[model samples]
Target: MGEVLVLTAAAGVPDAAAAGVAGRATRLAPGAIEVALDRPLPAGFAVPGVDANVVPAERRRKRLLIADMDSTIIGVECIDELADFAGVKAEVAAITERAMRGELDFEAALDARVALLAGLPESVLGECYAERVRLNPGARTLVRTMAALGAETALISGGFSYFTGRVAADAGFARNQANTLLVEGGRLTGRVARPILGRAAKLAALEAITAERGIGVADAIAVGDGANDLDMVRAAGIGVAYHAKPALAAEADARLEHSDLTALLALQGIAADAWVD
Candidate 1:
């Protein structure tokens, strides 16, 4: 009755037994294996191209999902894409990199980037969404499949609400939250609404939602790819760093580098056939 180590690959199931790990290996899906372990994972134990996670088997599946939208669920960072429309992509993207890496304060970075887009046309938001925004592979399946199983789903972001609202619908999240971009005279007002949704806000959303659902914080799974997502990710029962920056990856309970979002389901012992389209 020890913990289980979940090994998930992007293709075929990895052979944990063959890797010299001592355990009873169980295949959960085509590309997933669970190894029951009585002791800590041996030093340097790894399988090429496979992401591994060790957790109590009893807490494998979560009842709530709190996900960061930009660069985690979506392929592009919304602010960076919006900056492109404002002719400041290079400038803004640099700050974004630093912020995601935990080198810069998230709120300050957001303020500087939005300030650079002060005069951009409001219509440019639509242009960026149409031209640059896209759901990363397996995003919809991950959200919809979890929702199908009666779990609550929320998309929260440090990015603006405009993109989160649209992405949440496309990805089938039950609700969404993000900072509001202030607009005036058909152009950006060079400011976000007060009380910006930064790292602290993301953590608060996780707390509020879980409380509203009458579930413990440990009943949630939080996923993201930035430093802004660290708080809630660390607090959740399962915290995943999805193709993340090094800062987040270092602290995540599970890291998905080679596989897609469906791998999260695999970690939860859900097979591919049960996924919702």
Candidate 2:
């Protein structure tokens, strides 16, 4: 398993950056190149618009994909948008930020935020989904491509099941798991169901989902953007932080700051032209 540098940039790998490569670039797409180097990446070697990952050509593609829903797959945090109906967007979004950054306890933060939504009509959830919730760039390509390649895909979230169920169906995820929001008489009870699905449950779901596919944790790739996703992100062999929170970006194996969710496909040696719609 020699070092392979995959750079995604317009000017491509500057001659200075590919100093130790033993092979020529096999262009995966515009601005993306794969070069096998005789030696490992040098210390502090980095280029702008270039994402360098040293992976074995054989183990690049993963058999399982576990992804976080909010701010990773979808563009907005569902809870924050739903809170707008209750006129508590600022209050709930603040908590959502802290929870994602790892500064606040996940379950407690979720409980406090949901408590603020008490008494809002449950129909607002639908409105928020239709108008506020949106798929991030490259979300479908990432999932559809992996699923097309025989990988098992799952959407796991600390968000409510209402959104996950819809997103899973719309995005073609094989399965999904999430916290259930309690509603009474078409209005939110402002309470989450018992045994809230938090950080631990996410990690557990990762393990369970992969096991069903007859693969171990090392064959899985997990992507997320928040603190609650930290555990599972680290648990997978390929943990990616997609436009992530500071804590998650610092801890995950790779950070996708510039590219969309489809960057995950590049990490797995999939070319842009090969991506599924």
Candidate 3:
């Protein structure tokens, strides 16, 4: 068999023939189609609001999933939300935008943003998570479904651990890792812990987890939405850019433009009926 072209849309199923893709079509879900193709689609072919990718039939389902947290699994950037509680949201969010777009050093941008929040009460962490953070649509289903099938799921982020821990548990990830924010005397110390978790650390987590599972990097799938996620996204067998920044999106094996997180399951050939919700 040649490569399988998987198409997922947020609304209706896309027509393979319309895109000049010839193959045996199988409906993986209401808005997902998998086609066994002898030839790749024409160059520049795309359907608005649809995500497309071609993968080897034998390697569609991955054994491990390593994903980013802020702006990927969850709907908001935790740092930006934390900054909001300190009355510096606009200033901090601008830095965050640049950092995610690959224009600023992750650690430096993080330090600058955290510094702006110094003196804010530590209780804001819990309040920010409770009032501002939310898992994006289908996030829970995606993680839980993968875990149910015996895949190891991990949430790795450059964002803070306080948020990662809660998001990971809410989304059903088996494990989680992230940088730590230091608090002193019930107030922000304005410093992230030493040896921050950035792009390199995210990649290291992928490598470490795959090794512990006795599998190659090719057995893993990674998804994220920022430049900080570039290393691991490129290292995984199936790297998905989930509503990503342009830099990361350009390098991803698949881009999820309109669909929610369940699209990842469809990309791996899991039928909608089999999704855990």
Candidate 4:
């Protein structure tokens, strides 16, 4: 058999019909097939006649998982839920959408959004955290599998601690770092603590976690969906953009487009079926 070339479309392009073409080409040795395409390929579709062992070259044996919270671990931005509490979802969400898309300055957008929450009752924070936030589908399975493999997990977010703390516990992260919101007199003071955790801080969290664990950075994987996560995403040995913005998807080394968080396990050579729900 001849070597089969694995092909993928560009970052955003996914053509089922073209993939059918690639699929037929699988008559060649799968190991010999090099996927050269402009966009992402179909999920879970492997070429025939190819040795599974040789098909995936960049197999990850990760020791640490550094995940972003908003739209990654969870379904929605925690901060947007917070904005909903104050009935400022329209105003804050616009800025948040821009910031997450890498269109606006992160710090400036955050400052503007937080400023709008000024004077919202402190109780609203709990309401948003308690009722609004939910783990993204398959998040638990992903975390459990990583932990079972003795990989340490940390949640590093540009989001606030008010949400990340609870999310970390629920998602089973070993450590978490995020910005702190300032509240006074049971109302938002409309300010975040200085040295706000942004892209740089997200990268630092990975460094700190790796240093404390005595693991090399090559054993780490980072996943996120926003522009603020670019620095750390690039820093990780394996970086994934999960349902990310166009810019983020363009920059990430790999992406999860068709499926949920469990799709990530495939990159590590761990199929999702082997993992318990």
> Which candidate has the highest TM-score of all?
3
- Separately for all candidates shown, the number of backbone clashes (residues 3 or more apart, or on different chains) is 0, 0, 0, 14
Q: Estimate each model's TM-score.
A: 0.95, 0.93, 0.96, 0.80
**Ranked candidates (TM-score, high to low):** 3, 1, 2, 4
lDDT of 2 by residue, 123-230 (tens): 888898999987887789889999999999999999999999999988889899999999999999989998999899999998887777788888989999998999
Q: Candidate 3 residues 21-100, lDDT tens each?
A: 77788888877888888777778877767777787788889999999999999999999999888899999999999999
Candidate 4 lDDT, 167-276, residue by residue in tens: 99898887889889999999999999998898888888888889999987767889999899988888887788887888787787776654567655544655444565
Report every candidate's CA lDDT: 0.89, 0.85, 0.91, 0.74
- CA shift at 210, candidate 2, in angstroms? 1.9
Return the lDDT, model 3, position 21: 77
**Candidate 1: tens digits of C-alpha lDDT, residues 1-277:** 4788888876766564336667778777767888777677988877778878887788788999899999889999988888888888999999999999999998999999999999899999999999988898889999999999999999999999999999999999999999999999999999999899999999999999999999999999999999999999999999999999999999988999877888888777787778998
Give me the runs in candidate 1 sitting further than 4 Å from their true place: 15-19
Give the clashing residue pairs of candidate 3, or none. Answer: none
The alpha-carbon lDDT assigned to residue 192 of candidate 2 equals: 95
C-alpha-based local distance difference test score of model 4: 0.74
1 against 2, candidate with superior TM-score: 1
